[model samples]
Target: MSEVVTRTERPAQRPVHRPVFLTRRRTYLWAAGAVLLLALPFYLDRFWLQAGLFAMAAAIGATGLNLLTGATGQLSMGHAFFLAVGAYGYCVFAGDGADGLTGLGLPTWLAAVLAVLVAGVAGGVFSPIAGRLRGAYLGIATLALIFIGQHVLFNARDLTGGYNGRDVPPLSLFGLTFDDRELVVAAVPFGSAEKLWYAGLVLLLAGGLFARGVLRGRPGRAMNAIRDHRVAAGVIGVPVARYRAAVFVLSSMYAGLAGVLLALVFQRTVPEYFGMTLSLDYLAMIVIGGLGSVSGAAIGAAFVSLLPQILTRYSDLLPLVSAPGTGGIAPGEAARYLYGAAVVAVVLFLPGGLVRITARRNRPTPQEDT
Candidate 1:
């Protein structure tokens, strides 16, 4: 007799519909953070506010650099040069041709926009080189930008105020001035640092969101493809050179915005601050935070930028750190050493950087049943 086989039918499973945006826990965390940020200016002093502002600016710059070097695999060593361009560009656009400086005396808002554009133009000018070169070659070529920028910043006194630098005109938006002039709000005196704190927050939020969108969109996919294999990406019809150049311009604009915020925070643009060291610091930030990650860049920026400030604040309690000129390792130097070691350690151990640590902690481990 012939044997008959029966087919067993399985029950259909419904697709799980998870929320695309924030979950309840994340929303609560975000709300808490916002409340804290809103209240910080009232409680924190100028020093802490200034330090936070610096971290915000660094985060913006690092995010841009991450887009280029980290996500796109394009080596860039001229990030600080773009920052200098933005800082001085803002001065030129906003200055009233006073103090023997050349300026257009544009509106503060217009000046800020123009400064960002100027940085984009500067990057475009270098795009040919950026588009053609890759890896260490591109990095070496970009290194020239720092030297050239330094020379211009020092010698072009009319434009950049030379070695002594120039004062940054206060930013005015909707009649509110981000200046040292105190504006009382909720019984708290809001000075330049305090006012700029809000401005910095706005800028950082916008910049981070925009960069995240870019990273999560079609452009991001193309960039990743080019990063993973340039030849294969090109064969698949990706415009390798154009994408590289465009990313360079975009990255420069981000740096430019950061420079403007930094100038506002410092109230002065010092040529010495935007040097090779600054560029290296940006590189270290991306490496330590996590390459190809927006949150990683921001996290790295805060860590690196805040380390020196934290060390200085508690130098007496720390053995290896001391105030500047105290003979011991200066806080800045100590920060550098710590981050340098972190960079090496991350590369050797966690190739994904510090972001992976958080990821690992959040990941659930599989359980084995006996």
Candidate 2:
């Protein structure tokens, strides 16, 4: 018996304890950002509030597009079509027939819900085409939706109010109405923009969280598989066509919700606003922000949507960028050119869009202590 009793094995190394400050850094940042956003309405003017609301709506729409085009590799050039459906659908559902337009006289909340569902149905109607097509083929097929939607919107005078569009009924829920009723809180008069600010924030947060969950789950994996390799994914038992169709429907619903929010913000729906140009703008947002990511879509939406507003606000101070109808380039046009260049730059150099910058900064260093 060599010493009969074996020495108890000790751990290979001491357990490492991360610093509390280091561990809580993300929580602190999130808290600070939340506090800042919540406090903005108190300090900012109506213009800024409205701009923020627009960004939120754009983020919602862009996130959906990212899911279809970015995550699932399905190209859609008719996102604006679904958005129009949602906007006009809400108007029709909640109009009360008082404005000389067709309406169902439904509650505003119900109208909003129904609008989203209608958009989903629209997507479902075209899902077969989506299932059969890919790349530019799918894009062209979807492009047809934009033309069809435009025709319907302009021709259906009763339901859509023709080219003039229709007024969006203010939402009433939980005894709180989101309108320009001038509710005062802490001495600040809460107008429609102010009231809708919180609602927009809530919607954006919920949509982002839901999208993130989808991306982190099985559906996301399936979408990615289809995106990366359709044939391989099929071989692995993933239903490529079904996933494509489902994602399309999901994306359309997102666009619908965003359209509803935008209608609320604008107080009126306009057919001209939801056009091919609008669809292109959404594609630019996902490209600039980083595709297949909620944060990416949001960041891109803010960048694209806010640039024009910022330029317009400071047109007098900025060189070569002037107010609309001025001698020089208009802020809107200039903003578009700038972001268009950004898209090219991202594709050539960054390849991951704006979100990659944050991801890189947050990534851990291999040399760091465990």
Candidate 3:
């Protein structure tokens, strides 16, 4: 016998949406931050402005390194090599053969673009090796780049100006040269630092946004898959080697752009600045901030880059720190010591990096039954 049954219809549930105010609040915060950054150069002295620019440039490079080392699980100790290529490449392309140096006399903007490309090419040349290796093996292969770059930078006298390095041609964009020409805005005298402040902000913002996109897109998923399990990723039809190579090139290009910005800010391209130490600092940035996170890279870059400057600027006011060469725990040394301790503390406790703190705080609480 067939059983008699009745069916009860339920009302359709609406899709859950976040509170409108939450989105509005984020937009408002972003607007406030942009306004603050734009206004900073007007009130800040040159020293502070320069420091901020340095931080921004470092953040860009660190972001790229994070994409490779953190996201792809590829260790790179040759980031400084690409940066050197960019810095020196710009000097060559824009130098105009002045001061007995070789140059193509190209437009400053074109030179910057070409410099980034040159860096990408450099990475492409090494991509095969990166594709084949992983972990410490890849790192060791990349480390050789630093030595090779050092030799080229020192010996290529006509291109690099030997040990002294070369002057960076002031960037000229749309008839306004980013030099110490003393342009005034709102009664405030604007120099290279002031002009480059806005440029640095723009570059950093663009880089951050692009990185965030990559991190959230399909490439990011493939990268994470490769990172988590290379053989499994390959088995799933992901081109693990190709992705690794592409990411390496992309990371190199980012470092190159950062190098160009740094050269513009300093008005010079020095070989000594782009070294193993700089690469290590970039690693420290990603690790201290949060691996595989753009905001984390920026935050870590700011902390790592600014700490030395802050210590030096206010050494007298702080204990266990003094002016450079004055002999009582020099500010630079002290800064390093402090960051080293911070790294240890972070590894021991906050393995997710400083950004995790905010993430943990922002996480929603689970509701309890009444």
Off by over 4 Å in 2: 1-22
| Sequence-dependent TM-score of model 3 | 0.94
Candidate 3 on 1-370: residue-level lDDT in tens? 9987798789997554545555577679889998999999899999999999999999999999999998999999999999888888999998898688999999999999999999999999999999999999999999999999999999989999888989999999999899999999999999999999998998999999999999999999999999999999999999998999999999999999999999998888888888898888898899899999999999999999999999999989998788767768997788778888888888999999999997765444432111
Candidate 3 weakest lDDT stretch, 10 residues: 361-370
Name the better of 1 and 2 by TM-score: 2
lDDT of every model, 2 decimals: 0.93, 0.93, 0.92
Q: Write the per-residue lDDT of candidate 2 for residues 1-370, one digit (tens) a residue.
A: 5767678888698555544555588679999999999999999999999999999999999999999999999999999999998888899998899989998999899999999999999999999989999999999999998999889988989998888888889999889888889999999999899889999999999999999999999999999999999999999999999999999999999999999999999999888899999999999999999989899999999999999999999999999988777799999999999999999999999888999998776655544445
lDDT of 1: 0.93
- Cα lDDT of candidate 2 equals 0.93
TM-score for each model: 0.93, 0.94, 0.94
Best by lDDT: 2
Runs in model 1 lying further than 4 Å from the true structure = 1-22, 364-370
